[model samples]
Structures are given as C-alpha cells and as structure tokens.
Target chain A: GDSVTQTEGLVTLTEGLPVMLNCTYQSTYSPFLFWYVQHLNEAPKLLLKSFTDNKRPEHQGFHATLHKSSSSFHLQKSSAQLSDSALYYCALSGEGSNAKLTFGKGTKLSVKS
Target chain B: NAGVIQTPRHKVTGKGQEATLWCEPISGHSAVFWYRQTIVQGLEFLTYFRNQAPIDDSGMPKERFSAQMPNQSHSTLKIQSTQPQDSAVYLCASSRGHERLFFGHGTKLSVL
Candidate 1:
C-alpha cells in the first residue's frame, strides 16, 4: 500500500517570510507526486507535479524538487504572501490509469501581514 | 471547459435514510475518482473508475457505501442507512488517464 506523510499540520508566518512544507511518500512502485492547494470554500487545484527527468516543478512563486532518493517533494517559497494562506496537500499515484491517489493529512498555512 | 461537476452542493439526511450523490466527469476524461474530506481525516480516497468500469474500491466502506459508473459521463455514490459519522464533504474528480486531477466543488453531506 502507498502512503503520503506531511509533517506540518499548521504553519504560520508573516508576509515576506520564507515558507516550507515538508512532504514524503512511500510506495512499492515508481511514484508520481503532486502538490495541491485549496483556498477557503474552493476546490483543490493542482499546484505542481513531479517530472521523471528530475526537473523542479514550480507555480505561483512556489517550487518543489522531487528527490527520489529521499522520497520527498518539499514545497518551498522564498517569500510568503497573504494570499498564500490555504490548505496544502501532497499526493502520490502509482503507474496506471486506474491508479488511486494517496493524500497526506494536509498542511494549513496561515500568512499574516 | 467545465471541470468535474457534482450535483447537490449540499445534502442533509436523517439517520437511516439514503443519500445519493452524482458526478459528471469532464468531457473526454476516462478516469473518475471519489474522495471524502473531513476535519479529522483530511482527504481519503473512496473509489475510482476507469473506462466506465470500477477499478478499485478498497477504501470504501463495505456495508453502506456503493458507487456506480454506468456511463462515461456520469457516476453516482449512494449511501444507505446514513449515520452521523458519514457526514463529510464528498469530492469528485476526473482526469485523462493518469494526468493531474480536476476536482469538483464537492457535495457537503450532513447527516443529522
């Protein structure tokens, strides 16, 4: 069985501060990792996805590097904005059209001005 | 293009009653997924369908939960004898093969 773990349940920071959300996964087969963001009262949207070529994926000033060796795809931002406050989820899928996703508990990020 | 569409943005059911949630996947997508979101559990995968066939439903509850995909365009999740513990947001998602999933706004099910 595959699973995803997010270490932080809540993260609070002021605007302009750097932010990081830790994500790690375990799987028997090769994994495709994803980052999703959900704003208040809105559905989750794909933020970024891992590439087999090892290129870092980034969106909206947030970036993540997939480290197969460590089974980690940590989300990072050099500076946080108030709008960045939301729930972030890390998910993993194996190889197949019917492959199901295993999602983390999610990290609630709160950015203040 | 419209992403995934889920009917009944909100549903309130009494104990012992039945509830049905509908989902319309994005046109041209062959895979559909159902997930449950709760304050305590976060997001949990319930089931999945591919090419209008049930692929995996190991996450679904054995007795009261059931899902069906009779056509490529629509799927349904039915819960019988609903209980308070079943209250949660039911999210529907669709994707082309194994690509990034597009989620619907979700049906907020409140079992009273």
Candidate 2:
C-alpha cells in the first residue's frame, strides 16, 4: 500500500515570510510526487509535480523537490503572499496498482498582512 | 477546456435513499478518479477508471458503493441506501498522459 503524510495541519505566516509545508510518502515503487493547492471555493489545481528528472518543479513561485532517497517532497516558497492562503495537498502515484494518486490529509495555510 | 465537470454541485438526500454523482472527464484524458473529502478525512481516494474500464476499485466500499465509466467522456459514482456518514464532498479528477490531475469543483453530498 501507498500513503502520504503531511505533518502540519495548519501553517500561518505573515506576508513576505518564507513558507514550508512538510510532505513525506511511503511507496513500494518509483514515486511520482505532486503538490496541489485549493483556493477558498475553487477546485484543487496542480501546483507542481516531480518525476525522475529531479528538476525541482516550480509554479506560482512555489517549488518542491522529490527526494527518492528520503521519500519526501516538501513544498517551499521563498516569500509568502495572501493569495497563497489555501489548502495544500501532497500526493503520490506509481506502479503496481491503477497508478492513482494517494493524497495526504492536507495542510491549511493562512497568510496575514 | 472545461477541466473536469461534476454535476449537482450540492446534493441532499434522506437516509437510506440512493444518490448518484456524475463526473465528466476531459475530452482526451484516459483516466478518471473519484475521491471523497471531509473535515475529518481531508481527501480519500474512492475509485478510478482508465480507458473506460475499471482498473482499480480497491478503494471503494464493496456493498453500497459502485462506479461506472461506460464511455470516455463520463463516469458516475452511485451510493445505495446512503447513510449520514456518507456526507462529504465528492471530487472527480482526470489526467491525460501524466499524474498531474485536474479536478472539478466537487459535489457536496449531505445525507440526513
């Protein structure tokens, strides 16, 4: 079985501060990790994704690196903004099954001015 | 493109009633997934389809839950004799050739 764990249930930071949301996964096959963000009333959208490339996927100033050795893909941002306030989910998909994603419980981020 | 379309954005049903949720995947995507979201459980994978065939339904409950994708364009998740515990936001997502999923706004199901 595959699973994802996000340690932070909630993270709050002031505007312009750094942001980091922890994500770790357990899988038996080569993992494809992803970061998704959901706005207040919008659907969850892909924030970034990682394959074997080790390219450090980035989108909307947020980035995440898949460390297969560590089995982690922590989401990070150099500077936070009000628009970044949302629910962030870390997911993983791989072989042996349908290749469907297994998502973490999610981390709610609140940014203040 | 309309990423993924899930209909009846909100649904309320009496206990023991039947509820059917619809999902329209992207035009050319081959994979469709169904998930349930709630306050306690953030997101739980329910089932998925690939190429109009149910490749994995291990996440789905055997008795009351069933899913079907008769064609490439649409899929449905049905719950029979729904219980109040079934209340949650049901989400449908699709992907083309990769794992980056595009999700719908989701259907909010409330069983009372």
Candidate 3:
C-alpha cells in the first residue's frame, strides 16, 4: 500500500515569507506524486504533479521537485502570498494509468499580511 | 466545461435514513471517483469508476455504501441507514484517462 505523509496540522506564515510544506511518500511501485489545493468553500484542484523526466513542476508561484532518493516532493514558494491560505494535500499514485491517488492528511497553510 | 458537478451542495438526513448523492462527470471523461473529506481523515477514497464500470471500491463501507455509474454522464452514491459518523464532504472527480482529477465543489452531508 502507498501512503503520503505531509506536514502535520497548521502552518502559519506572514505574507511574503518563504513557504515549504513537507511531503514524503512510501510506495510499492514507481510513484507519481501530486499536490492539490483547496480554498475555503472551494473544491480541491490540482496544483502540480511530478514529472517522470525530472522537470520540476511549477504553477501559481509554487513548485515541487521529486527527490526519489529522499522519497520527498516538498511544495515550495519563495514568497508566500496571502492568497495561499488554504489546505494543501500531497497525494501518491502508482505508475499505472488511472491508479487511485493516496492522499496525505493535509496541511492548512494560513498566510497573513 | 463545467468540470465535475455534484448536486445538492448540502444534504441533511436523519439517522437510519437513506441518502443518495449525485455526480455528473466532465463530458468525454472515462474516469469518475468519489472521496470523503473530514477534518479527522482528510481525504479518503471511497470508490472509482472507469469507462462506466466500477474499478475499485476498497475504501467504501461494506454495509451501507454503494456507488453506480449507469451511464457515461452520471453516477450516484447511495448510503443506506446513514449514521452520524457518515457526516463529511463528499467530493466527485473526473479525469480524461489521465491522472489530473478535476473535482466538484462537493456535497456536504450532515447526518443527525
């Protein structure tokens, strides 16, 4: 079975500060990792996904690198925006197509001004 | 596209009552998935359908939960004799044979 571990509980930061939400995984097969973000009262949407070619996936001022040796894909942003306040989930899936994504417990990021 | 659409943004039901949640996946999508979100468990996979057939339901409750995708457009999750512990946000997602899942706003189920 595959599982993902993310930063526990809440992560509060002042606006413009660096953001890093730790995420690690254990998978039986080759892993395909993903990040999903859910704002208050909004559905969770895909933030970024790990590339097989090792390109760091970036979106909306956020990026994550898949470190296979470390089993980590920590989400990072050089400057956190107030709009980054939301719940962030780290998910894992098998290399097979349509494999179910196993999600972490999630980290609530609250960026204040 | 409207993405995934889940009906009855919120649902209230009494204990022992039945609840059915509706989901309309994005057109041309071959996969539809159901998940339950709670503060305690975060996001838990319930079941998934691929090409209108159930692929896996390992996370669904054995007794009260059932899901069906009768057609390509819509699927339903029915909970019989709902319990208070069943209260959570039920989300529906669809994918176009790819891993990127587009989720719906979800239906908040409150069982009392």
The lDDT values for all models are 0.93, 0.91, 0.93
lDDT of 3 by residue, B1-112 (tens): 8889999899999999999999999999899999999998999999999999998898999999999999999999999999999999999999976678999999999999
Candidate 2 residue lDDT tens string, B58-101: 88989999999988989999999999999999999998745678
DockQ of each candidate, alpha-carbon based: 0.78, 0.74, 0.74
**Pairs of residues at least 3 apart in sequence or in different chains that clash in candidate 2:** none
lDDT per residue (tens digit) for residues A1-113 in model 3: 77899867799999999999999999877788999999999999999999999999999999999999999999999999999999999999855765678899999999999
Q: What is the TM-score of chain A alone in each candidate?
A: 0.96, 0.95, 0.96
Model 1 misplacement above 4 A = none
Candidate ranking under lDDT, highest first, comes to 1, 3, 2
DockQ of 2: 0.74
Cα misplacement distance, residue B43 of candidate 1 (Å)? 1.2
Docking class of 1: medium
Q: Kindly report the root-mean-square deviation of model 3 from the true structure over all alpha carbons.
A: 0.9
Model 2 collision count? 0
Write out fnat for all predictions, comma-separated.
0.79, 0.82, 0.66
Chain B TM-score of every predicted model: 0.98, 0.97, 0.98
Error of 3 at B46 (Å): 0.7
